[model samples]
Target: MSRTPYTSATSQSAKMRKDESFLGRLGGTLGRKKKSKEVSELHEEGKKAINAPMLPPGTDIHPEDTLLEENAERIMLDPTSRENPKFKDMLKVLIDWINSELEEDRIIVKDLEEDCYDGQVLQKLFEKLSGRKLNVAEVTQSEIGQKQKLQTVLEAVNELLRPHGWSIEWSVDSIHSKNLVAIVYLLVALAMHFQAPTRLPEHVSVQVVLVKKREGILQTALVTKELTSTTEMMMGRLERDAFDTLLDHAPDKLNVVKTSLITFVNKHLNKLNLEVTELESQFADGVYLILLMGLLEDYFVPLYSFFLTPESFEQKVHNVAFAFELMQDAGLKKPKARPEGSL
Candidate 1:
C-alpha cells in the first residue's frame, strides 16, 4: 500500500495462494464436524428402527428373527397349497395326456430273430421248407389276409393278455385311430371283465378305429374319454408278488407284435426281389395294411387296457363282479384253435 513497488501478476498469484490455503484448512475443519454429527444421527435412527419392535411403542414382531421366521414359514406352507392329487394318479393322467396329444407319432421297432415274436422262426421254417416262398405280401393283401394278420397280432397280444385273465378283440364299429382307440377299447374291455379297482377314470375311454380304408391309404382315429368324479377310496397297494406276476406273465406282447409286422413286411419285399408276380405290389400293400392293423392291436389298443386295468392294480380282483356290472365290454373271448388245427 505504501508504494510497494507495484507488484507483478506473479506476486499477486502467490498472495492469493496463501489466502486460499488458509480458507481451505478452516473449511475442512467445519465440514468434518458437520459430517460427524450427521453420521451419529443416522446411527441413532438405524438403531431405533432395528429395535423399534422391542421398544416401548414399536411393532409386536421381534426384529432379530423376523426375516428368518418368514423364510421358514414360506418354505413349509408353499407345496401344500398347490397340486393336490395322488402321485400315481397324477402320473397316469400326465402320461395319458401326452399319449393322446402325441397320437400321431408312429412307433416302430425292429428285430431280426425269427422267434423274437409269435414263433417267427416257425414262420420262416414254413417259408424255407415249403419249396415255394410263402407269399406273405399276397397273404396280407386280401380281406382274408388282413383278418389273418389281425389274428396273428392278436395271438401275440394274448401272450400278455391271457395270463392276467385279460382278453382283447376288435371293436365292431371299425373305428379310427387304431392305436389310440384300440388301447381305449382294451382298457374298457378289461374294466368290464375284471373286478379290479377303477384305475381308469370312470368316464375315461379310448377308441382307436378305422375311419376310412383305401388299398394304399388308411385313415386312423384315436380318442380318449375322460370325466371328473370322486376318486374311489382304496386300501393298501397290491401285493408285490401279484403285481410282478402279472408283468412277468405277459411281458412284451406289444413289442412282439410290432416286430412281427416289420419282419413280415421286410420278408414280403425281399420275396418280391427274387421273383416277379402280378400280386407282388398288391401283397406289399397288404403287408402295409396289416402293419397298421398290428400297430392298432399291439400298441394303440392294448396300452389302454394295461394301464387302466391290470392284475397288479387289483383291476381283476373279483374277475366277475364290479367291472362287469358297471362297464361296457369289449374283449371277452379266449384263444381258440380250429377243429382241423389249420395253420
Candidate 2:
C-alpha cells in the first residue's frame, strides 16, 4: 500500500486538533465534577453549621459578632445622614448587651442536671437558626425557679431592648420542646423586629413570638420576633389576630372577614358592575390579604423610615416577601377565600 504521505504541517495540525479535543472533553468533565463537589460541600457545611453549639444568647463566638457589625457599619455608613452614626452606636451597644446577657444565661443553667434539661428537639431548631446549640443542662429548670428566673431574664432583655425600641414577651408550653425552643424563637423574633418604622417614622413596633411548641413542654423554648413599623404592626396584628381568634373559636373570625369582604364588595360592586364569579370569590379574601400586606409594608414602613432614614425599607420589604415565600414554600396552606356575599 502506498504510504499516505501527509505534508508535515498538515500532520502537525491534525495531531494538535485531536489533542485539543481530548483535553477539552476531559476539562469539561472535570469542571462539572468540581461544581458538583462544591455544591455538596456547601450543603454539608450548612448542615454542620446549623448543628454547631449555640453561642450564649447575648453574645457571639469567634469573630462572627464583630464581623456582623463591621459589615453593617460599612453598608450603613452614610456621611450625609446623621442617623448613620446613631445606628452604628446603637448596634454596638446592642451587640454588647446581647453578649453580656447570654453569658448570664450560661451561668444560670450551669448547675442544672443534664438529663432534666435535655432538649434535643429544641436544640436542633436552635442550631438550625443560630448555628449554635444551647447547653440545656447548663440552663435547666431545677437550677433556677421558673417564673422568677424567666421574669428576671426577661427584665434584663427588656432593658437591653428598650433603648433600641424593641419589646420581648415570654410564653411557656408544657408539652413539646418547652423552654429551649421558646428562647430560640424569642431571640430570632427579637432580631427580626428590632428596627425603626419606615412609613410611620415616629412609631416603631417590634413584636417577637415565643413558643415552646406544644403545650406543657416546659423544658423546651421557642421564640420568634418580627419587627415592623407601628402601623404595620397594628395592621398585622389586626389581620393575624382575626385569624388566630377565629381558629380559637370555630367559625367565628370567618364571619367577620366575610362581613368585611361583603362590605368591600358591596361598595365596589355597583361601581365595577361585575358579578362575583366562583374563581373571583375564592380569591377575594386572599387578594385582600395580599393588598393589606403590601399596604402595611409600603405606605406604613416608608413613612416610618422617613423620620429615621430610608435605609430599612428595602430590607424590610425583602424580608417580608422572603418570609411569606418561605412559609408558602414550606407547605403551610394558604387560607381559602370565602365566597363573596356569603355574609
Candidate 3:
C-alpha cells in the first residue's frame, strides 16, 4: 500500500526524450546506408559510361574498327582538341605539305577548316594527291554548290583510298560544316596514303566529352582517347627507320648520347635530391621527366597541372603529355618520343 507519488509530467518528458533519441539514431543509420548506396551507384554509372562502346546500336564492328570509330567520335566532339599542340603541329605540317604539293596551281592554304570548307581546296588537294582531276566544280560560292562539290570530292577520295584498306572517317556534311577533327582525319589519311614527306605527331591523345540521353535525361562524361592507328603506324615506321640508322652508322654514339642526356638530366635533378641512373626506365613513369623539365627550364610547374603521384598508366601518360606541352610553350621543339613511349 506504500506506493510513492509518481510525477506524471516528469515520466512523460523522459519517455519522450528516449523516443526522440531512438528515432534520431535510426534516422542517422538509414541516412548513411542510403548515402553509401547512392555513391556506389554513381561510381558504377561512371565506369559504365567511360567504358561503354561508342558505336551505334545494332552496328557490328571489328575490334580494330571499334578503336578507330571511338577515337574519331571523341575527337569530333572534344572542343579542346583543336588547341592541342600535337594537333596544331599536325595541322601545320599538313598545310605545308598541301601548299608544297599545290604550289604549281598557286593555291596556298592559310586555314584548314575555313579554306577547305568551300571544297575548292579539297578538290585541288584531291586532284594533286590522286594525280587526276575530279569532275567537281572549280569554284563555288553557294552553300549548295560547296556541299555538292564536297560530296563529289569525298566520294572519289573514299573510292580511291578505301580499296587500299583506308577507311574514311569524314563525311561530306562534316567537311562542309568545317569540322576540324574530320578535316584533320581526312588530311592525315591522305598524307599517309600518298606517302607525303611530312612527319605527323604520334600517339596523340585528347580528352573528349560524350553526351548521352538516358530515361529522357541527358548525361555527359569525359574520357581520353588516342587517335586512329594511321598516325601511330606512320610514326612507328619512322622510329624504326631512325633506330636502324643509328644502330648501323653510329653504334658507339648511342652510348655517348645516352651518357650526355643522363648527365644533363642529373645535373638539373640534383637540386631536387634526385638522380636519374637509367633514363629509359626512370623516365618511363614520367614523374622524373616532368620534374627534370621543370628544373632545367627554371620554371615552376604548378602541382595542380600534373599528378604528383600517378597510380595508373593513363595518368603517367598524361604527365608526359603535359611536359611536352610545357616544352612547346617554352618555345622548344618537342622530342620525337610519344607520351606513351616514355612508358
Candidate 4:
C-alpha cells in the first residue's frame, strides 16, 4: 500500500490559511474596540452638552431681581432648615396646637402639607378660632373643588387678619398646592393671631429655595429668613394676661395631651411588657411610675421599698413619694408635681 507523503507545498498552504484566520480575528477585535471608544466619546459629548450653561455669553443675570419676580415659586425648604432641631420642635408645637384646637371636632392633623391641602382642616380651624364659619364645603375631594374652597377660606382668613393690620403671607394657590413653607406660614400666623393657648417657639428660622423663570430659563436662589420672629413680636404686643392651663381653657386638649403622654410612656414601658392607657388612673397607682423611673435611670429599685400592687390611696401615695425621692437621690430635679396629685 502506498501512503500519501507529506509535501512542503501542502504544509505551506496550511500555514498561510492559519495566518490569515488570525489576522482576520485581530482586525475584527480592533474594529470592535474602535467602535466602543467612539460610542463612549459620543456619550461624554452628549453629557457635556446637557450640562452646559443655558444663558448665552454676555447675557447679564441679575440675581436679586430674578429671584424676586412675582411669578417666582418658592419651591422647598432647604435641607438644613428642614432637619434643624429647632425647626422640628417648632413644627411639633404648631401641630400640637392645631390638634388641641380641633380635637373636639375629631379633626386630627398629622401632617401640615397632606392634611391642609384640601382646605377642610384649615376651614374648620378658622371657624373654630374665629367663631365664624365660611360658606365653603366641609370636605372636597376634587382638585378644583379644593381650590375653590381654599380660595373662600383664605379670603375670609385674610379678612380676619387684615383687621389686625397683618397682611396674608400665603395664597390660596400656595396652600392648595401643598407648599409646606406657605402652609407653615399661614398656620403660624393663625396660631399667633388666635392666641391658641399653646406656647409657640420664638425666633425660629428656615432656609428656602426660590425658583423663577426669566427669558425661558429657570434660576434658583437660596434664601434664609425668620419664620417666627414676626409672630413672636405680634404675640408680645398682646396683653400679658395670665395664660389659662389646657385643662381649664380647653378640656379637649387635655385628652389629646393625655393620649400623647400615654403613647410616650407606653413606648418606654413596652420593653418591660407593660403598656399605659389612662395616664391619670394608671399612674395614680404609682406602680408604673416607679418602674418607669427604674427603667429610665437604669437603676434597680429594691422590691421591698415600694408596693407593687397598691390597694389603698395611702399606699399609692407612698409608692409615688418613694419614686420622687429616688429621683431626687439620682440628682434629678424634683418635679413641681405632687405625688398626691397623681393619686
- Tens digits of per-residue lDDT for model 2, 1-343: 5445667678989999999999999999999999999999998677436534332232212232123321121111112221344333433433443443344344223211221133322233233334444333424454244443344444444554456544443342211213322343354344333321112221322222221212211111122223224443533422244555677787756766767766665444434354333433333233333333434344322333222221343443434333344335446643221111111
Measured on C-alpha atoms, candidate 3 has an lDDT of 0.73
lDDT of each: 0.35, 0.37, 0.73, 0.75
TM-score for candidate 1: 0.20
What candidate 4 gets wrong by more than 4 Å, as runs, is 1-71, 230-232, 237-343
TM-score-best of 2 and 4: 4
Q: Put down candidate 3 lDDT per residue, 16-45, tens digits, no spaces.
A: 999999999999999999999999999868
Q: Which ranges of candidate 3 are over 4 A from the true structure?
A: 1-77, 211-219, 223-225, 228-232, 235-343
TM-score against truth, every candidate: 0.20, 0.20, 0.45, 0.51
* Candidate closest to the true structure, highest TM-score: 4
Separately for all candidates shown, the number of backbone clashes (residues 3 or more apart, or on different chains) is 20, 55, 0, 0
Worst 10 residues of 3 by lDDT: 62-71
Clashing pairs in 3: none
Q: What is candidate 4's lDDT per residue for 1-343, written digit by digit as tens?
A: 4334557678888999999999999999999999999999998676436434543333343444345444555455666677889889888878887897799999888888899998999999999888896998777889999999999999888887877766566887778767788888888778767655445567888877666655444555667767777443756534343223565687777777777888888988998999987776888878998999888888888889999988887688688878877777889865445465465
What TM-score does candidate 4 get on C-alpha atoms? 0.51
By lDDT: ranked, best first:
4, 3, 2, 1
Q: Which candidate model has the greater lDDT, 1 or 3?
A: 3
Residue 115 displacement (Å), model 4: 0.6
Q: Sort by TM-score, best first: what order? A: 4, 3, 2, 1
